[model samples]
Target: MGLTSTASASSEPYGHYYDEYSTVVDVTDVGADATGNEPITPVLEELRDDDTLLVFPEGRYYMDEQFRFTGFENFGVVGENATLVPANYYDFAGPQYRLFRLGVSYSPGDRIRFEGFDVDQTAPDTGIRTIEAYAAERLEVRDVTIHGQHDSGTWGPGMFNVTDPDGTGLVDQFRAPDGGAWINDTPTAGDRWRGPIGIVANQNEGTLEFRHCWLGAFPDNGLYAANGNGKIIVHGGLYRNSNGANVRVGGNGSEIRWPTVEVDSTRPEDRSQRGIRIENGRNITIHGAAVTITEPEPTSHAISVMNTCESARIENTRLELQGEDVNHGIVLSPDCGEATIADTTIAHETAGGYPFWIQDSDRTDRILAEHVTITGAAGDAGGFRDGIRCERNNCRFNYVDIEQPGRSGVNRNAIVNTANELTVYESNLRASQHPYIDIGANALVRDSALESSSGREAVCLYASSTGPAFKKNRLAQGIRDLGATDVTTWANTYE
Candidate 1:
């Protein structure tokens, strides 16, 4: 449908919400009538006061190197099924065509909604980015698909080396004089280097929401909203197979933050590196999501909870570790804030090692896990041990089931408590290959079952100061003191 003929516009939709002097112009009218050289600025310059530049439906609206939509609030651009196409400024001089590239930059709080459009970057300005919403506030980019597919490079080396970034990051910035300038373009440059994600609200304290959209293969991440205290919500979309993480929040060295990433994958990856990674940010929550990542060489963990995160919650999620040589289900390193893992299942190790590995950074940190199941598949042979493993003074496991098959299979323990004051209640640990009772300091094992190989000790209490208490338990062979602190058993009978 054409923008002006809408029921709202026919009866003066602008009159109800806007002033009389408001201008409405369809960007399709700016094209070349004779197919030669036509500048689109004059058509945009005619924008009157309170005017809404209604971009027409289903047509390519080309832009010069740098199209500036600035200093205009209460007047915005709205279009459906419209594509804002960007091109480079080519200067024909001395038989060689020199290319100048430009990017689209906008002001803050510009209530603009770019819906059902594809921003194409198949031109020069290989370093050109699509929409830079610097100082922008409340910009909503929905149902917009953006990709950098064309090759545009001058000489020398380019900024995006898709294969390897050497030391520097994937993206580098350039100063465009008039939108189209020869950027760092080379043979080994990355694809999707031209078009950037539509809306980027960096350093601007505005709320940005990306819903039902496909944003991928860009030079930077699909959506990068950071620097300032901005709320970013990405829901019902597919973010996959990119140079960087699907979504990245919080920049370098900048701590004390609150950012949220909520996703429900349409298609999942078994070997996903890190679904939602938090570096120096507080109050991060991920709920009801399934992440399947390939465990490529040097396999990345499913989730890496880094330093000083105040509150992190992962609920009703499934993490399948499908990697090659390296894999850790969840790596909770030192000095973590407060972490909670509830109602989750982890299975099928494509690579090597355990199901859940928790390494400590500092002491006295807190972790609570409830109703989590850790199991191994056929590919997961012998050394697939330790369901819940943690360092001293770190974590607590409740109502967890860590099990393995026959004695010929590799040993696996239910709860490997390496931390002090750790407690495991109402859980079952039955492994045929390894010992069942793997305890550390001041740990308490209550009302649980530890079943091991025939004739082997079911509970092997490791040497520590506070002898772990095994109460109301049923075991195959019973508890073994590996020089542990003290072994206390109450009304427990073993075979």
Candidate 2:
């Protein structure tokens, strides 16, 4: 396994790089007793100012409380095929003790590194947080597996629950379904108790990265990286079988932070939640990855981007099905947030859902939808759906194909545009019935083939002539101005 930033430091030919750093301490030998049922704090305190802690060359160790550390610089904790178990699940639920607190307030000028370890929670509700890098730099968590269960009956599963505690403080009594015994009755209580991915960074201005790891299975989300005003990146990891969402990225200010989260969804469809969610952040990029929520019969939506994001990109991804009636493959609500979705394929979505649904987000301008394909299975009789539905202005769509089965029912709109200044060009709009394109106001439909049922208009422009222009459309019927009987002919040759 390669380290996040230290891949160049080729000290060890195989295994982890810490093997080259001789100043290593075996937690068990240092009085921690890897197999002992006690906390590892005593052994962790005895280490030198700069030492690497090793555990379980091939075994497991359980931890009950949050791992607390202080006064260590360039500290390293390494393990392979080893497990760090929590003493009790309750310790991380309501009390929320972080598994490890690196760069403590008292010791502000220290560094910590974790590698090749299997970190899990004893109870379902307990979350697995790696470290909160406060004022610390050059920290890395690589080749480590953080595991937890979405014990539906339990309070919280894999990650930390920072929200308000639920009615049942214990995980055993909580009531929901599927995974654990503790499943809350209230709608809001599900994520509140289940906790998200344990790795959280608050108010930090440093570089933090997690590489080649497995992170997921919490009540709320898989990972929560918030209050961040620095550089953050995640690459080459597995996020699956989780309860809530997969990842959350946000922060205050406009200093333009660089945060890139790329996850390889290479597991069974039953291993994850929402793909990637970004709220209140800027300068974000999600590229070279895949997202699928497969379970519950047919899968639901894959990814959702909302709440004022800017300079965002989604490319080279696939979304598979899990359960039935899971609508909207990707929901983009970047109100005033500029984004681009290109070269992506969304298929096998059984439900007559929108592959790309963008609405009422701030900036309508600077949105580019290109070379995307959305198709449904054969014998799947349903129409009046959309390949891409946008309700914002200044939007542009080019070279996209939206195909649907069956005739256009009263419920479908192949391509819905409600923006003030919208443009649809060089696209294939194939709806088996009704209208292929439905325009709201001030839009332009150029060089696009709008094909639908016979006698129905190909482009339904409900806009006034002074609102926008409709030209270069190949359709059965020409553009129909709102409330006007006369149809305006464009340079388009009818098919």
lDDT of each: 0.48, 0.52
Off by over 4 Å in 1: 1-21, 30-42, 45-51, 88-107, 121-128, 134-137, 147-206, 217-222, 250-272, 378-384, 392-394, 404-408, 435-439, 453-456
lDDT of 1: 0.48
CA lDDT, candidate 2, residue 350: 45
lDDT of candidate 2 at residue 339, scale 0 to 100: 76
TM-score of 2: 0.74
Per-residue lDDT, model 2, residue 294, is 43
Candidate achieving the largest TM-score? 2
Q: In candidate 1, how many Å is residue 334 off?
A: 1.1
- Residue by residue across 18-61, what tens digits does model 1's lDDT show? 23214554556544211224444445545422336445445565
